[model samples]
Target: MAESRSETLRVAWHGGDRFEIQIRGHSVRVDEPKDFGGSDTGPTATELFVGSLAACVADCAERYLHRCQLPAGVTVTARYDLGLQPARLSKVALDVEAPGLPEGLRESFTAVIRHCPVHNTLFRAPEVTFHVLTSGHEAVCHHP
Candidate 1:
């Protein structure tokens, strides 16, 4: 059997329906509906997805601004509208505010936005597969 390129995350129930996720040396506590086997505290999975998107965009914007020799005070604000029923993401908007930037820097920044990994991934649909692992089981799969 071959090892998988993807990473494995371990999750354990802390108490009162809250779960602790161990990934990349970080521990994240997550909970959900009180009756749905989770605590009423913390954001839901869908909300977390949007949160990840926002964080990725912010990181990209900050890195781009730093690489472009911009000032130290650059900020990005992002918001999203989620659709009901199907629970799909409807729209995502971003506002960039930077001080001490040259006159035509907005265009350069917009160009960088097009290359953001999260934005690109959201726009493109990639194949996704799920595997259930037991106590000492391993699953290997390839992604094209």
Candidate 2:
């Protein structure tokens, strides 16, 4: 049987282009740069998006090394380019480094990290739907 899971996050505006996000009991803040008219308090959401991918890849690499009974030291540097026409990310590149990795294991390690959940998600886009709720005495939360 396939395992199923559900995750939810809440984001609330914290004044002037800043937002506070709650994720599984941890809180993170995100804001735009001063040039973008924000207070420059924290990383932008776009940066977090790319960072999540990098972290996921690194985590996969580390786990693979641990399973092999080797030191799980992994580093991932990520770069992305934005497409102005669509105002979206057009290119993303990741450079993963695992020092002292055996040459024989390099190919397998690369293959393992490439299958990270974040990488898989980007390769297959998920459907998104939005529902708007307005304040009213009779309003109630609905799940679908």
Best by TM-score: 2
Candidate 2, residues 1-144: lDDT per residue as tens digits?
189688899999999999999999999999999999999999999999999999999999998988998887789999999889669989999999899689999899999998999898988988889877777665676876
The Cα error of candidate 2 at residue 104, in Å, is: 1.2
lDDT of 2 at 14: 98
Worst 10 residues of 1 by lDDT: 1-10
Worst 10 residues of 2 by lDDT: 132-141
Each candidate's root-mean-square deviation in Å?
Answer: 6.9, 4.9
TM-scores for all candidates? 0.70, 0.90
Estimate, for each residue in 60-136, the C-alpha lDDT of model 1 and write its tens digit.
76777789777756566768887888779888787767675677877877777666766778879668896677778
